[model samples]
Target chain A: MFKALSVREPQPACADVEALSETPVETLLELIDKAQQPPWVGMRAASCLIQGHADAVQDTLVDWVQQEDSRGFAILVLNQIDTLPQPVAIAVATQALAGPYASDATSRIAKSTNPALLALVP
Target chain B: MFRLPFALVALILLPGCELLTGLLNGGSGMLETRTSSVQSQDGIATIDVDVSGESAFQLTATSGQLLAVEAVNAPDGSQPLYWDDWSGVNSLTSAVWLEGKDTVLNWPVRQADGNLSDGTWTVDVAVVDDQGYYTDDQVDVVLKLKDDSDLSTGTVNARIVYADGLKQDSVVTAGVQDAVTRWAEIWAPYGINLETSYEDSSFSTDQPFPGEGSEQAEVSSGANGSEITVLITETIDGSTDYYGIAGGIPGTLDYTDHALVIVSWLTNAGGDGEFSDDDIRLFGETLAHEVGHYMGLFHPVETTFDYWDALDDTDDCGGQSACESALGDNLMFPYPVCDWTSCTPQDQLTSQQAGVNQRYTGTL
Candidate 1:
């Protein structure tokens, strides 16, 4: 169960502490650095789009999609998207997985067998 | 350190062309309320400004009306919150403000190169905080634009319900009500604002042993203060098809007293389809854009374009993959015959910047 946090930029975007993966708080700065690299390239930067649009965080990635990747998108598959400690984050993400890629052939991403997330976050 | 004169010249010149930040006109003219506060909700504020106050503020060039804007966010003084009105969008910046508003304390709009219409507008400062209802709480700011003989006008006061089409207040996220709120906000800059009563579109989504279907639901908002009333009718007998439309200017509805009706096919529900964020934003954009036509705005590039390409097409999330190139990349892109997402979030936001109540501009 490995979750990856992808941030294209630091400071206001990835920052420190914003990555609350249950126990510790570390800057996803490393995640940003890693996700933008190979093996992760073309591998949708999940938060690359969400992180850039999070409350208080400037939505630079949304524009990055237009100016950078016009057709394809960058996403990050995460073992966990719950740091907000609230279920709304999962609800929001569920709304995400429900749309766009809901029909993608990737059975893992589409069906979302892990109903555990819905119970945990909301 | 060495070239002090050059440094001063560069700094001075940059201030004049600061782009979206010019809302203040380098003075104290621009007053903005932040919608960055977030509450326990997923990520949307339920707010509605009383735009129908008895005391009207004449929108002169120098002194515009007073408006109280609201949004959903964390309470003030706790944490700095920043949110974009447009979510579910992939290409455009959902949040539009100056690069450093909290630091510099100046709110600006994010207008990239491709906004076809003139989108130099500012966020209204009514609510002053970010945490608001999913529907925006707005001030009743009355305005009168210049008299353009060609400018056709109408009002669209509505209460959008689900396919059953009855008035139900159960709230659904990223629902049709949210879509319409976004539309009205886009049309806010224009003279089209949604009525306060119907602002929050928390319609009922209840079901029953209910031999009823979601797809064949007749969802239409109640008509009140609007000259034009719009209703979204669904025709599926199963778990009905749904839609989101902001009734104000962003709905792109220009009629003063007619219902710019929107209908969705029965099969569009959770029935398998890869819905793109681009498509959602575009759907919100296009439906309103077409409604704008109902209000009397001509197509930006209707000469060689066709709106009929989407008559029965549902493949590209209501978008016609073929007509993107022929039409001028704008809200009114001329292809009205399909179901693909036609309008972009930027198009709606930019259109909201029109400011129809900003008094009759001699230049405009």
Candidate 2:
């Protein structure tokens, strides 16, 4: 008999940011590359990488935002990481607002309590 | 004076009495011996009996409620069953007046204890006159136990119809089955057992998201006839659309038993290098959510909003606007996250929801 789908493993990207910090950036990039492919392993990888190495992978994150397949995940990662430079964050937010993630990006921008980010909502 | 005459006639006719003498003396008002037998349909037993006399009669059951009562003489004359405060009045009592003729009374029986048992049951019918003189008669009824396993079980015929450009993968097929079966297990305690079957097929639509046309096409393909038909596609309209969209209430559509979930959303949602447990669970939760809609469930909202599922026990978010805070981790919450290792109480169906799910006619 086929085994039923079970949530046996530790929770995905959101659970342990500390554990994600140990994952290699190359592997994370590979995961992001296949984000549109089946099985959604890439999305989980992207979540971990973005959560753990958002500051270190800024250039790669920018590249992701330029592609149709990875833009949504890239925007989600950029919006979640607080440590990223304010200028880069604003640029990414601006791009997300203009792209398919406009509603989600707008909601995030409107909810941001940061003075600099709040000013960019409109 | 009447008593003295009746006693004198009974004494003289003790050895050889005519039927007229018995009727006049009220000694044998029972024209026929009380006999009863039960015939069950849809888990309820109907007790049929013939009682005849020239007096008023009361029928009482030992252990079950009379669901319905009907008089044979006036076929349309049926009374709702009600019970008196008698010690053994476990069921109902029907006080009927026979106009000096034979009448058949039908009593539909339902177990009061909620246990389906097979054995002999008894009913008592007593005939009484205006003067309070009465005679009692008893009848035995036999009921057979029914098979209860299939009471709430249903089937889901999952049809995985990928978009024109997408390739079919066995892993995705197995994962979809796993999700549906897991939902079945979650509902097992509430008497909902779901059996699922999977088929891999494709459609020519370039639109990633399925619209009404897609649903119509899927239904026309004869997917899961009368059972739930879930169409899993690679994408919906675009990669950015909703993860899934389910029809509201089972019978609302002409097809009546179909749902559409996006496998591409599942893939896009997971950034992991491979399918993880959380990924599978998220997929399962999405499927369960759509099926919940098909099962007549709505979002738990407490406001004047139109989308409220209308169940009381489910946490009622004030409205769509307050759903983010009030919805919490409820399974029927509009946008639930599946990042937990195990399901919470909020993630499972409330008792009322389980009942509704069991009562869904589409799955039946």
Which candidate number would show the highest DockQ if scored against the true structure? 2
Chain B TM-score for each model? Answer: 0.33, 0.48
Q: What is candidate 2's CA lDDT for residue B317?
A: 49
Report how far residue B83 has shifted in candidate 2, in Å: 36
Local error of candidate 1 at B121, Å? 35
Model 2 lDDT, residue B55, Cα: 18
The residue-level lDDT of candidate 2 at B132 comes to: 33
> Per-residue lDDT of B243-279 in model 1, one digit per residue for the tens?
2222222211111221234433111111111223433
How is the predicted docking of candidate 1 categorized under the CAPRI scheme? incorrect
Per-prediction TM-score to the true structure, in the order listed = 0.28, 0.42
Tens digits of per-residue lDDT for model 1, A1-122: 01222111110122333454442221332333233221111122223334343332223222222222321221222222333223434443454444453322133233345456544322
Residue A31 CA displacement from its true place in model 1, Å: 35
Off by over 4 Å in 2: A1-122, B1-167, B204-211, B214-220, B251-269, B302-307, B317-327, B337-346
A1-122 per-residue lDDT for model 2 (tens digits): 00011111112333332344455576557544633332344445554556566677767666565555554465445446344567667666666666655654676577566677677667
lDDT for each residue of candidate 2 in B1-364, tens digit (9 for 90 to 100): 0110011000001122221111111111121112233333332233432222111111222222222222222122333232222112111211222111121122221122122122222222223233433322222232111122233444333444544423354445566666666666666666665655555455542233323454544543454323455666544443322456554332121232223434443443443212446556656666666666655565554223333543556554454446645664556665442222323333566766665554443333
Q: What is the lDDT of residue B193 in candidate 2?
A: 52
